[model samples]
Target: MDPLTPMITTNPFDDDKLREECGIFGVSGADTASAIVALGLHALQHRGQEAAGITSWDGHDFHTHRAMGHVAGNFDRDEVIRGLPGGSACGHVRYSTTGETSLRNVQPLYAELNSGGFAVAHNGNISNAMKVRRELIRRGSIFQSTSDTEVIIHLVATSSYRTLLDKFIDALKQVEGAYSLIVMTPEGMIACRDPLGIRPLVMGKLGDTIMFASETVAFDVVGAEYIRSIDPGELVIVTNSGEIRSHRPFGEVHPRPCIFEHVYFSRPDSIVDGSSVYSVRKAIGAQLAIENPVEADYVIPVPDSGVPAAIGYAQESGIPFELGIIRSHYIGRTFIQPGDKVRHLGVKLKHNANRALIQGKKIVLIDDSIVRGTTSLKIVQMMREAGAAEVHMRIASPPTKHSCFYGVDTPERTKLLAHKLDVGGMQDFIHADSLSFISIDGLYKALGEAKRADGRPQYCDACFTGDYPTTLTDQDDVVVTNQLELLAERVA
Candidate 1:
C-alpha cells in the first residue's frame, strides 16, 4: 500500500472548537530557571502549540531560545536547556491569535533599551495595538515584531520614567485591553495583569524560586506550591536578591476576568479564581440539564472537553452516563490526511460512535459549545448511523454569537453559526431531534452567581453577550485594520 500521506488542512477539528490563546510562564531566583520554565511551558502546551520561546537573565548576559514547535519537542533536549543558563527566566507558548506564525513574532521578546535589557511574554490581545502602533511610528519608535506586545517595548523605551519598573508601569497606562504579562529584566522579574484582569495569571513558589504562569497547571507541572492569583492591576517585582515587592499602579476599578476560562481555556484539574475548573464545568452541566430536561436513555459527552458536563448532566437528570463516543488521543490540530477520502471522514478521525452503547438508544449529547456546528452536525449523523433512536444535543454554554477579540482565535462573527442562526435554525442545521443551550443566566448560576448581572457582570461574556468591557480600537476598521494585522510585520 502507498504510504498514507500526511495532509495539511484546517478542516479536521480545528474549526469545531475555539482556538486557545498564548500561555506565559516565568520564574526567578532558581538554580535552573530555564529548565523549570520549560517544564511549566510544557504543561501549558494546550494553551498554544504553534511556537515556544524562553528568555533567561544570568546576571552577566541574557539568553533566549525560541522555536516554532511544541515545547516537548524542542525544550526536552538538555542541549537546548543548557543553552539558557540563568537565575531568572520568562517563557511563552504561541497560538498566533495576533501576529502571523513567524520566527520574528515568537515571544519572550527581548529588547535592549535605555533601561537595560528587557524581555516580555504576554497573554491576551492589546485591543488598541494598532492605534498605539500608528502613534509610535509617527514618533520614530522602531518596532521589531508584528505582535501588539512589541508596542509595550516602544512605550517603555520612550517613557521618561526614572526606573525600569516605572517605565513599564507608565507604558501599561497608555495601552488598553486584556493582558497578563511576565516581564524579565536584569534586575529581576516583573509580573502583572491588566486593569480589568481579562486574562488569568497566577503566582506560586518552589523552594526559594518564585513562579508565575498563565494557569495553575504550569505550577503543577514543575511541582511548585500554589500561591494566590495575581490580582488585577497589581504588579509584583522579584529583585535579584530574591526579595519580592508589590505595586498597584492602576487606579481602583472593578476587574472583569474572562468567563470563557471556566467554559473551556483552563485545564480541568486546575483551580482558577479560587474555584475548581472541573467542579464549575460540572455545575454548568447540571444547570443545563435542569433548564433543558429531556427523555433520553443515556447522557453522552462529546469526549474530552465535554466529559465533565456530561457527568454532571447524568447525575442531575438521573440518566445513566455512557461513553457513546470514543475519541482518539492522536488526533491533533494539524495532521496529514491521506487524501480527499480521509478528509471527508471528518469527525471519524477524532471521534467514533461506540456502536454497542449508542445503538437503539435515545441519547443526550453534551458539548461545551458549538463554534461552527460542523462537528455537531457530523457527530449527530454518526449517532444516527450507529442506530441511535434519537439524539438530543445539550450545550454547556450560552450561544457563542460574537467573535472574541481578547486573544482567542475566533472566526468572524458573520461566520459564527449562532450569529446567523437562531436556536431553531441551529437545531435544524445540526440535524438533531432536539437541541438546547444553557441560558446566560444558567451559565452564571453554574459559576456560583444567582443570575447574570447586566449592570456589572462578574466576568467578560462578550463572546456570548456582546457586552465588551473595553473599546475595540484596532478592530473598528475591519478592512484596513485586518489588512494591517495580516500584512504588517513591524513599524520603523
Candidate 2:
C-alpha cells in the first residue's frame, strides 16, 4: 500500500457532516504566552485538525512556528515553547474551508509591514477575497499564499492611512463577510469581530493576562476567566503594559451570529451567544419531540453529536434513551483500506450498531442535521442489520437547504440532500420508515427566541433559510470570471 492510501479512506461517518472552519487563540501580557496558547489551541482542536501555527512577539522580534498537523506533536515540546520566548502570543488551527490544506495556508500569517511586524489569526471567511485579490494584483500587490486571509495583510499594506491602527481598520472595512480576528503587532494585540458577528470570539482574563479565543472552552483550558464575547464591529486592544482599550469603528449594526454554532459547530460545554450550547441542543431536541411525536421502543442517538439531542428527545417524549450506536473514539480521521473489499467497512471503524440493544426494537434515531444524507442512510441500514424492527429518524435542526459561504465547509447547494428532496423523498432515499426535522420556528424557540422575525433574523441561518446577512462578492459570476483570468495570467 502507498503511504497515502489511508488518506483515501476517510471516516465515512465524519465525511457526511459539516466540517468545522478554524480556531484561533491569543494571549497578551502573560509569561510563557506560547505555551498558554498551545494549551488553548488543544482545547479547540475539534474546530480545526489540518494544521496549527503560533506566532509570538518579544520586545524586539516576532518568532513563528507552523506545522501541517495537530498542535500536540508540533507545539507540545518544551524546546518549541522555549524558542518562542515572548509575553504575547497568538495561535491558529485550520481546517481549510477557504484555502487549500498546505503549509503555506496555515495561519497566523505573518508579514513585515512599514509599521512593524504583524501577525493575524482568523476564524471566518472573507466573502470578497477573490474580488479584492484581483484588484490587489492589478495594483502590483504580490501574494504569498492562496488563503483568503492573506488578502487582509495585502489590504493593510496597501492602505494609505498614516497610522497602523487606521490601516488595520481600513482593511477590515473593505472586506465583506464574517470574521473574528486576533491580530498581533509590535504595538500590542488586537481582537475584533465582524460587523455582523457571524462567527464567534470571546474575551477572557488569566490574572494579569488578556486572552481571546474562537470559543470560551479554550479559556477554560488555560485557567482563564471568561470576560465576554467580543462585540460585533468592536476591537479590543491590549498593550504590552497591560493597558486595554476598546473601539467600535464599524458603528452599530444588526448582529447576526451563526445559529449553527448551537446546532453543531461549537463544543457542547461552550457558551455561545449567552446560551449554553448543550442546553440549546437539548432544547432543540425537546422542541423536535413536541413538533414530531412518534411511538418507539427506544430513542437512539446516531453517536457523538446526536447524544444531547437524543437525551432531550427521550425526556420530552417519555421514551427510554439507550446507546443503540457505539462510537469508537480511537478511530482516526483516516484509516488504511487495502482494497474495495475493506472500503465498505470504513463507517464501522467510527461507529457500530449496538446489536443486542437494538435487536427487535422499534427505534427513533436522533441526529443533529442531514447534509448529504449518505451517513444517515448507512446508519439506518446498520440499525436494520442489527435487527431493528422499525427505524424512524429525527433531526434536531431544520433542513440544510443551502450551502454556507461563511467559513463552514458545506457541499454545494445542488449537492445538499435537503435542497434536492422533500421530507418524503428524503425518507425514501435514506430507507427510513419515518423522518422528520425541527421547524425553523422551533429552532428559534429552542434558543429562547419567540420565533424568527419576518424582517431580519436574529441569527445567521443561511444554510437552513438562505437568508445570508452579507454580500457574497466572490460568488458573483463576473467577479469569478475575472478572478480566473487574473490567476491564469499570473500562471502564464
Candidate 3:
C-alpha cells in the first residue's frame, strides 16, 4: 500500500490549522476572589490547561497573578492567591484558539479602558475575528495579543455608551458565533452568553456573593448554590450590593449548546442544562454496542474520554473490560512544544500501552472522535506493536465531518478524514482491522431521554447534524467602528 495514496491531503481547509477554545470563571461579592477563582478554576481546569490567570480588584487597583502552566504549578504557593486581595475578581484558564501557546496568550486580560477600566475572561471562539481585526486596524485600535478576546477590549474602549454594560452589549452585538464571557469593571462583574447559546455559562450564589462559571461543577467545588444558567442572549450584572441584573439581546435566537460537551468535553460529574454528561456517554456506548456489535477478547478505552463509554459497551456486549493503556498525570503543556519529534516524545511521556493486557488478544478500542487522524494512527500502531492480534475501532459518536463555528475548534471539512474516506477507507488508513461509528439516531438515544419539548430533556447535536439553531448574518460579522459613530450621531 502506498503511504501517499492513503494520505488525504488535498483539503481546501488547512490541516493542523484549527484552534481550541478556552474556559472563563468569575466571582463577585466574595471576601477573597483570588482563592475562590483558584479553586473554581481547579474544578473547571479540564476546559483549559495551557495557562492560568486571575485578577483581583482591591477597590482602588487590580492585583493579578498569571503564568503558563496548570493551576497547581502556576499557583503552587498559598501566598500566590493570598497576595491578590479583592472582594470581586475574574479568572481565565486558556486553550489558545488564535494565538500561540505562550504566556502572552494567557487570559484575565486587563486593560485601563474608561474611567476605572475593564478586565475580561472569555470562553469560545469568534469566527469573524479576522474580519473584525482588519477593520479594527483601520480604526487605529492597537492590539496587544493575537487573541480574539483582545478585539472585545478595543471595541469596549471605543464605544460611546453610557455604562460599561452598554459598551459590552454594543461590542457583543457586532460579534458572531459562540462566546460565553465574564468581565470585571471597577464597579461590578458581568457575565454574558451568546444569543444562540453556543457555549454553556451558569450562575450560582455563595450567600451574598454571586458566582459565574463555564460549568456548575466549579460552583459546587466552592460550596455555591446553583442558580440556573445564564440564558441564551443574556447579559448578567453582579453589583457590589449583591444584586443580579439580566439583559437579553436576541431573545428569539434558538438555544444550541455544543453537543461535544456531553459526548467528550465535560467531566462526568458535571451537568449541563440539567443533563448528566456521564449518563449520556454511557448510554451512547450502550447504543453503540447494539448498533455496531463486535466480538472481542477485551474492551479497552482510549483512557480519559473513552472510559465511560467503554464501560457501557462492555456491559451491553457482555465483554470484559481491561485497562490496556496507562496515562501519566504529570504531563506538562507538551502540546505547546513545536516539532513532530517533540510531540511524539510528549505522547510517549503521557501514555503507555500495557503489553500483557493486549498481547495476542482480539481487542476493541473505543474512542470519542478521530480528529486529523495523526493521534489515532499512532495509537493503532502502538496497540499493534504491543502484540494485539486484531484491533477493532469503535467510535462513540458520529464522525466530526465539519468544523465547529462555536467553541469546539475543528479544522475545515477538507482536513477531516471522515469527510474524505468511508468507514473501510478509515480502517485502512488507521491500520485497524475494522472501524465502526455509532449511528446518529443511536447517539441521540444513548444521550438518554432528551425532553422533546424542552420541558422534558434535550441536547444540542449541532456538531453531528449541523442543524444550527441561529443563522450567522453579515451584520453579526460587522466590525464595530463608523457604524458606532453613525449610531451616536443618530442618537444626537
Candidate 4:
C-alpha cells in the first residue's frame, strides 16, 4: 500500500463514469500543521475535485483558509499555509452532495461557539439532517449552510455534557448515517468513525505527531507510520500533551466498509485495514473474466480508475489489453460545468477514441461503475464511430440500483440504468454488442476474505443490495427539522 507505487499495469482510457467524493487529512504536531495538512491533502486531491479547505488551531485561536479548486491551485505556496499559524489542523477536499457547488458547501465547516472554542471540519452525510434541522429551529438555532455536517456543530455546541468528547458522543447519538469526521478544536484534534464503518478513517503516527485521514494515503504522504483503521464506532482524541485516548461507543458492530471505496473511491495504493484495494479491484476484474467472459480481440479500461481491473480482466480472459481511448489531460472534469451543454461537451472533449487501435477490433470495454446511462451511451457511440467491430461492455461492480445519501452523488433509482433494465435490456439501451456486470458475490470475493473482529464476514452493499445499516425517514422536512432542533438545543 505504498503511495509511491501505482497498481495499474497497463494504459487505460479515461472516461466520465467514474466519480468520487473528496479526501480528508488532519495533523497534530509541533509546528506548521496547516502547511503539512495542505501537502497531505494535495496527495489526496484525486479523491475529490470540487473544493479544498484547511482549518488550523493556534493556541489562542483557529484560522481557516478555504477555496473552490484543486489543492495545488488553491494553496500553491508555503506562505498560504504558514499564514494560518496552528499546530493542529484539519483539511478537506469536497465533492458536493447537498446544495449547489459553491463556497457555501465547501467543508472544514467552522463555528465559533459561546464555549469560547472554534469547531471545524466534518465528513459524510446525515440522513436525518432535515429532521435534525427542524428540531434545531424549534429550539431557536439558525443555520447558515445547507450541508448536513453543520448539524454536528450545532449538536456538539448544544449538548449538556461538560466535556467536548462527551458532547460529541451525545451529538453523534442523535444523528444516523455515514461519517468519518476529523474535528480541530482549541483543546486538540478529534477523529471518529461511523457505527457502520460506512466511510474510512485511519490514524497514524510519526514520533509524537498524530495524524488522521480519510485514507491511509495521507499517512504515506506525511511520512507517518501507518496505523490501522480507527475501527467502526471508535473515537480517538489527541490532546495538547500528546496523550491519545480511544473510545468505542459502538463496540464491534459488524463492519460494512463502503464497497464503493474499494471499487472506485479510495486510492489504489491505500490498504484499508489489511485489505488491499488495488488487489481487490484486480480480483474483481479477474472474477468478471471468470463469471462473465466475453469474446473480444482486446480489453480496454475506461481509464484512470478502470485500468487495474481491466488488466486483471485481460489477464484472466486471455485478451490483450490496449489503450483504445486517449483521455485529454488538459480538460476539466466532465461533471463540473455551468450548464448541461458544457458537461456534455466535457465528456467528448476529455476522451477521444484511438482509431488506429480500435478500428475493426472486437473490444471489451471495462469500467468501474455506471450511474446515469448518458455517459456510457456517448462512450459507446465514440467506440462505434472509431470503427470497432463490436463493443462488449463489462462493469467491475454490481449494478447500482439505489441512491447514496452518504455523500457519493448518485442519481435517484429510476435514473439508474440497471434499476430499470437487466443486462440484456441495458445492452439494447446503450447499443452495445453485449453487456455484463460483475456479480455481487464476485465483488465480495474480489475484495478478498472479509473477517470481522467477532468472526463474521459481511460488507455493505447498500447501493446494490438496499441493506442500509441505519434507517432514515422519508419525511424529509420533518427529519431535517427534528435533527436541527435537537442539535441546536444540545449544542447551545
lDDT of 4 at 19: 48
Best model per lDDT: 2
The TM-score obtained by model 4 is: 0.89
What order do you get sorting by TM-score, best first? 2, 1, 4, 3
- The C-alpha lDDT values of all candidates are 0.88, 0.89, 0.76, 0.78
Estimated TM-score per prediction? Answer: 0.94, 0.94, 0.85, 0.89
Scored against the true structure, residue 470 in model 1 reaches a CA lDDT of 91
TM-score of 3: 0.85
lDDT of 3: 0.76
Give the least accurate 10-residue stretch of model 2, judged by summed lDDT.
1-10
lDDT of 4: 0.78
Residue-by-residue lDDT tens digits, candidate 1, 217-302? 99998889989999999999999999999999887978889999999989998888888999999999999999999999999999
Residue 319 lDDT in candidate 2: 97
Could you tell me how far off, in angstroms, the CA of residue 140 lies in candidate 4 after the best superposition? 1.4
